[model samples]
Target: MSKPKAVVIYSGGMDSFTLLNRVINENYDVYALTFNYGQKHVKEVEVASTVCQTLGVAHKILDISPINQLMQSSSLVGNIEVPEGHYEDDNMKSTVVPNRNMILLSLAIGYAVDIEASKVYYGAHAGDHAIYPDCRPEFVNAMNDVAKIANYEPISIETPYLNSSKGEILKDGLTMNLSYEHTWTCYNGRAKACGKCGACVERLEAFSENQVTDPIEYE
Candidate 1:
């Protein structure tokens, strides 16, 4: 029997990395999609490419850099400095790209429909709710509604980690024996991860919670 097809919204971050591996392990033929939206962390796009190539997973990367001019207030897409602190710190709100996940999910849905794939796997988790409004459960629910009616061929948004914490998501990935070295989490595009950045801090906390060493290098 043929496996079910899925479009995985892969950012090459830990969450999406884990989700991509999990969906592949679940017997889905995966098509990974990475976005190049002029974020400082475009290194993640390169990581996604390498991981997909090594895993023999079909992958597509989209360049949507023109919108960066509209979202200049965001540290992720603009020249602003990324705030360094714990994930829950209010200053970390600077990293929230305006409607990023909405834009990504919309494109992923279009890809899934184009390929006749029934599902689009997203890596949204509870940890992002404190910072990114688009990663909230309410946003997922609303997007699911639009995904259904946006086209005659409905595509389901599957968020297996919707209620899971970052630590829990890491645990699941570790259980699958997936390596985190293939992922990139730092908000900055430095050669080494800045451990003090909010993205690095949250990722380190997840690794600490799992009692596992993060395979990625940091400075």
Candidate 2:
């Protein structure tokens, strides 16, 4: 008997990495999808690749770097500097890739329709509400409406951590005994995590809130 099918937007970051595992644990035959949209670094892609391989789940990295041209206003796409601060700070708006979630979810829904997967999973939590408008519940609700009507074959969009904080998401992942070492959250994508960056700081804080070692090195 085949388990149900689902697609996970696995970005190799702590949140998505956790989402990937959560879906698998739910007994879905998971297809892990990663996008190389020309971010500041490929380290997260590299990390996602390794973890997906280790888990023996089907995975693919799509190169949509050409679209980076349209998204250059954000610091994450081109030569702009990645600012360092609290994840909720207004300065971190530089890290926002305009229409990122919409674009990614559109593709993921298409993929799900192709694969006959009934649902698509992603990690968008409460913590992102302040910095990323698309991560908020209203966006998810709106996107969920579209996902069901986007095609003849309806698809469900699942956000398990929608109301949770980063720390809370990490807590669920920890309960699964997942390792954080396989994840990469640094926007800098340097040799070591620039612990000062917004992503890194949030990751570090999550681990702190859980009262556990982050298990990754930082600069």
lDDT of 2 by residue, 24-78 (tens): 9999999999999999867999999999889999999999989999998899997
RMSD (Å) of each candidate, 1 decimal: 0.8, 0.7
Global lDDT of each candidate: 0.93, 0.93
Lowest-sum lDDT 10-residue window in model 1: 94-103
lDDT of 2 at 206: 95
lDDT of 2 at 63: 97
Off by over 4 Å in 2: none
TM-score of 1: 0.98
Report the backbone clash tally of model 2: 0
